[model samples]
Target: MRTLRASVLARFSARASSTLAFDSTSHLDSLQHTRIQDLRSALFKGGAPSRIWAHYTNILNYFNYDVLPLELHQQVLRQCSPPVRSVRLSDAKRLAQGKRLEHRHLHEGRFQAIISNIRALGCTPSLDDYHFILEHFAAVGYHVGCHQVYQEIIHLGLTPQTKTFGLCLQAIAHRLTLPTFEVFRMRLVSQTRKALDDLMSDMRRFNVPFTTANLDLALRIFKETVDEEGLNKLVKWTYGIDLDNPDCSPLDLLENQTTSSPQPFSTHALNTIIDTLGRFGDISKVVQAFEVLSQPLPQAKQYRFSSFDDEDDFGVPVHVPSPSNHSLPYALPNTTTYSMLLRHISRARHSTLARHYLIQAFKLDRQ
Candidate 1:
């Protein structure tokens, strides 16, 4: 019985020794990972010693985060340096390309650690850095969290003087539904007028041409704020017409009657006016605006026909009896009488009558 007890004790001691060996191996592996992360961090810092990158690459090849403790994993990332310019442009490019290629292998804890460090430092990251983090989050298909990062930047008040804020705004704008527009308006209005003004000024100063779709958005907002008279003034002003100039009406500007070279309003601006008119249900006013657009002025010469065979010839002319001459005892031929009446109506550009004739022709064809 004593021999059996001694044998059992020896077996237990051997198992304990094996467990200790395993633990020691794990601790060494953990230490190596920490060292590797430290090397990677050093490589990112702007003024690190030249030998660091080589060691970083070597350590990166061996370290695996799957088995590491969460705390140690974080420690690894915390030890890393911020990205910096490489010794050579090619080296920098290589680093970028490598990151692009291997970014998928990046651990989430490491990223969180880096971000926490960035926040703690209270330094606004470069646009590239922000975009990198954004892309990282996006690649994981986690848009909600990505938006939170943008919100964080705004909350921290680190978004000033950065195009990243504009990019974030644009992204949110694109994703915004009608239901979200109110929220967008509230948030945008909450920004300081200086910030808003700076954004607008940058847009103009950079000559950054906005798309028609984006301009439509601006027009929608503008329409919501301005009354009819104010809107009309805006339209005229956009065409370089001064409303305060008693000599120039909106029509005069449309006609390019000003002394300066005629600078017509853009098609987008014109469309905005047309849309505004339609939204107000001013169909007749819209037609009047079209007429004003169609009319030939000094700036826009009317085309005249020199000869029937000329390419520029408009069409053949038709003669019509005067309205006073319609009282004839001798009845005119039915076709000729109707043709003369139609010619007179056409000369007057009677669109209602023209449509009536078109409908009658269609009915006659059906018959």
Candidate 2:
């Protein structure tokens, strides 16, 4: 039965093009003279006629990404009711599965048909369905499909959960070539701000569990807006409040001060901050943050090192020359220690200091 259904679906798709061509020529004169009233009258008189399945098949035939007139396309949507729309969508999905259809071609057809159907339904598709389509299109790198999905979400008055919103944002962020970034920044900024405000209000009013992931997304968008100072201020405010009152902040409950390793931030958040800092050439701030993060706690004295050979090598021991004190013993330098420091310094572009260590590395290599 499934195979039979699949075969019928394929046949319908094959015939769709010819039907579309015939409709385009025969309807061209009427379509050119058609008013919105005529279209509305056709839709309300008996939306989704028995002939709709055939009409849909014909419409699909004429649908080319490059050439379809938007008005005539919308008129076809007006002819379908919800049930017919659903049927058409199912047919589109089945047609998309054909091996001969390229990803781009399939995506364009499916996207246009799905969007038109959504318009006919007078409501948005469920979030799960929207996500499935968005992910499918995004994987194929169909930017137009992705944009349509985003616009549909907005048009449908659906506000996705933080995780879902974050995933969408990250997907766009990952694919942000320079041109795409510029376009996204211009097109999405206002919509994004409204969405962010809605999300923030939800978090504040409902006692919704705002995870680090949520904060990370907010941070990323802020970075995109080129508001580093604003981001830093927001972070300081939020973290300070959380630290001062653990009872009020879910994030505080997750903090682990006893662990020596760094806590993981969301990769999206970290990447955004790193990219922002790099763009501004604030290398010193990066180094300073690393230095502070690397510091040992007072209770961690047992983990701190006094000698380069010490197993707990958290702190380095180095001597500075003094004008009056001359009785200090000549310390035997650890070549391994010097070599490691040289590697770090070189990577950080402190070439002069690195060169001194490089000289010692050569001696150790000789030994």
RMSD of each: 20.6, 19.8
Model-by-model lDDT, in order? 0.44, 0.47
List ranges where model 2 is wrong by over 4 Å: 1-106, 140-148, 177-279, 296-349, 352-367
How many Å off is the CA of 11 in candidate 2?
42
* lDDT per residue (tens digit) for residues 1-367 in model 2: 9999999999999899889998888786465334433444555565554354344444445443223344444445434433433643544575567532232324345445746655564544566666655555544334444555666676677765545555454444333322334554666555544444554544444434445665665666665655555455444333421212212322322353211222243334333444544444454543333223223223333344454553335565556322221111112334433443444455678777567657756876799
Q: After best superposition, candidate 2 residue 165: deviation in angstroms?
A: 1.5
In model 1, state the lDDT of residue 1.
100
TM-score of each candidate structure, all chains considered together: 0.33, 0.38
What is the per-residue lDDT of model 1 for residues 131-235, given as tens digits with 9 covering 90 to 100? 655544434323344456655655665533334444433333322221234655555333322232344444444444444444444445444433355445434
In candidate 1, where is summed lDDT lowest over 10 consecutive residues?
A: 324-333
For candidate 1, the TM-score is: 0.33
Model 1 error, position 209 (Å): 5.4
Worst 10 residues of 2 by lDDT: 322-331
